[model samples]
Each structure stands twice: as C-alpha cells, then as structure tokens.
Target: MNETIIRPNPSIVYMIFQLKTNQPSSKLIYSIGPNGVFPDTQGMLQQHSDAISTVIDYSQGETSEVSYLKLRRSHGVINMTSWSILMIMGYIIARHFKKWDPIWFYLHASIQTISFVAGTAGILIGYALSKKVDANVNNHKNIAIIILVLGILQVFAIILRPKPESKLRKYWNWYHHYIGRILIIFAIANTIYGLSLAKEGSKWFLAYGISIAILVIITIILEVRMWIVARRKTQSTNNSSHPQSLEFAYQT
Candidate 1:
C-alpha cells in the first residue's frame, strides 16, 4: 500500500472576508475549510454565510448604539448639526431683538469656530475612511467640501461685517442673512444623509428626526413671539401718533 499525504493551500482552500481601515491590521471574520475537504464542508460553509447574512439583515432594522467606527463615519454629520443649532439660535435672537445680540454673536462665533476645528478633523478621518467604505466618494465628498468652504466664507463675513451705523450696513446684513441661510440648508441635508450611513441601526435616524422636530417647534415659537411683540409696538406707536383717530372712531 502507498502512503498518502495531504497539504492544503490556505489561500485557495478558504474564503475569508475582512474589514480594513487605513490605520491598522484588518480583522477577518471566518475561514471556510481545508482545500480538498472544502467541498465536503459545503453545507457548513453555507450555514455560516446564512447566519452572517441574517445578523446583518436584522441589524439594518434595529435601533442600537452606534459603533465607534460608525461614529467616526458620522463625523461630518456631528459637525454640521452643531453648526446649524448655533446658527438657529443666533438667527432667533437677532430677529427677535431687531438688533444683533452680543451673546448670540459670541455663541455663534464659538460654535462655528469649534465646528471648523471638528470639520477639519472629520475631513482627515473621512479621507482615510473613504478609501475603504463602500460609498459614493464623488457625490458625498465633493458636496461636503463645498459646504465647508461656504461655512468658512460665512464666518469671514461675520468677522468683517460693516459697523451698524455704516452706509453699507444694511447691504451687509442682507448678505449675511442670505449666505447663512444657504449654508444652513446645505448642512441640514448633508447631515441627514450622513446619518443614514451611520451604523446599522435606527438610533441615528431617531436622533436626527427628533432634532429637526425640536428645532421646528422652537422656530415657530420664536416667530410667533416676535410677531406679537412687533404688533404691540406698532399699536402703541399708532396710539401715540394718532390718538384722535381712535377717539373719533369710538364717538362714531
């Protein structure tokens, strides 16, 4: 009888999938089987594939804490949300007071400054992660860059705005308001899309939905309060300027 021996080539024998970040060693999930025996283990390998698919499918519909990697993926979303909240607060205060609020201005400046720093960090991480993640790099990355550039320009405008008493002040105000609004819209849209790409869970979606709802309520309240105040001021001024008009109407 002749002696028989077997040697399996690991690479050809097994099928393994791994996630690789640019930073470190890739993590492998599982291996199929030894070379010739792999055909014998087909049933077991199919089972493994099915189990993995089931887990991923379940995760897609679940609400759960985001993984550290997913959070890293959502860096741009976090940055833009922070920036938008600050802008919303600033706009409410400025519009309600009919003049710039120093506190609002300072807060806006601080938030934008922080956002700029965070956005830079995000860009660094995103560039590294983009190469690995299965995402549309062109649309996602290019739009994000445009939003950031616009945000920077808006900050510069805030810093270089004309004095309130200057002849160009009104024009500057319009420019500031329009540009700020445009940046905010872009930020919100990008944030929502980024949230969708967050970990396989519903938490990101819930967080985003709640944020938008709260902001809408706050904005409506602010608008109503400003309108009421403006109406009262107009009534008082009219009463003083034309007191006889009311008296004459009452007599008739």
Candidate 2:
C-alpha cells in the first residue's frame, strides 16, 4: 500500500482523500491547535511527504521557528474571505435594517471600515501569493480588484455624506445607498471567483461557496421587498392626489 503525508501551515486545515475511493482517510491533521502536528511557532509550513514515519513519531518532533513566507500565505486566504463577506453582505444588511436608530449606520460604517483595512492586507498577501502559486489571475485577482475599488468608493461616499437637512442630503443618500449595493454585488462576484481559485478539496472553500449562494438569495429577497415598498408608496401618493385633482376640476 502507498502512504501519503501532508503538512499545512498553521491556521489552515487540510484533508487528504483518495480519489479512487472518493473517501477521506481516517487520519486527518491540522496545522494549528492541539491536533496540529507541525511546529513553526504559528503554522507557517504544512508539508506532505511520503508516510515513512508513523503519526505518533511525527507528532513528537517540535520545530517552532517562525517563517514569514508561510505565515503570509496562510493568512491571506482567511482574511480575504472574511473581509469580503463583511464588506458585502454584513454591512449591506446593516444598512437595510437600521431604520430606527443612528447606531445601525455607525455599526455599518465601523464594520466596513475594518473590512477595508483587512481587505488591504489581503490584497498585499494576494500579490505575494500570486507570484508563488499558479492562481487564476484573470478570473480571481482581477475581479477582486474591482470589488476592492467599489468598496473604497462606497466608503468614501459614506464619509462625505451631507447632513440630513442639507440641500444635497437626498442626493447624498442616493449615492450612498446605490454605491453600497453595487459594492455588495461586486463582492459577491469576487467571492465566487475566489472559491473557484481555492483548491477543490478544501472544505473551507466549499463552505464559502454555500455561504455565497445564501447571501445572493438574501440580496434578491431584499431587493424585491424594497421594490414592493416603493410601489406601495407610489400608489398611495396617487390616491392622495386624486381628491386634489377633483377639487381643481370644480374650480375650473
């Protein structure tokens, strides 16, 4: 029987499965936590080699030297997924539901602000990882850049929004709302692309795929609800104006 070995950086979990059997082996290892066998202070390098040594033998060795290269690579994917989700569905939902208090807007703003910072780090790590891995640059990286740009624009509109009673207030609101929605849509697209870029066997990537689908469905529902509300408002306005029109007719 052939034996396989895998070593993954810390903070990342990797599983190996036999393609012929379509089943994961009984032995599973993580790069972090008590089960994590690799030692690089913080799970920098996960290595897979021929299974010459037993699991017990491998687990006994300790090598805790921190490696910058491996740590950066491992951190990028996690941060990118987290920030992308926040900038898209998280903040947008806050905007949609926060009608009663100013705190919702503040919360939305704060989350996106943190997401932007995280996103910046993710992008830098992406650039470095791209050089090392055969990532789908056109499909994943390009789309991500588009999302980052739109996110930045949305944040800018948020920061420069006019006061509530200002003459430009309505326009500012429109800009803020529309741009945020656009950012959400782009973020969703980028997330799907990122999922494709992740390795096929990665459970984390599969979970992300499911989450993206759910977010997309939720966004559609929200849009339909907004449309219904707008239509009702229009109909109400028309009904209210009918009496005025009748009064004008009598005057004429």
- Which model scores highest in TM-score? 1
In candidate 1, stretches whose alpha carbon ends up further than 4 angstroms from where it belongs are 1-77, 97-101, 132-134, 244-252
Clashes of each: 0, 9
Cand. 2 TM to true fold:
0.56
174, model 1: CA deviation in Å?
Answer: 1.0
**lDDT scores in order:** 0.62, 0.63
Candidate 1 structure quality by residue, lDDT tens digits, 128-224: 6655443345666776787778777877887798988999989898888887778777767766766565443687668767877787798898889
Which runs in model 2 stand beyond 4 Å of their true positions?
1-80, 130-146, 164-186, 200-202, 247-252
* Candidate 1 TM-score, true structure as reference: 0.64
TM-scores for every predicted model: 0.64, 0.56
RMSD of 2: 11.9
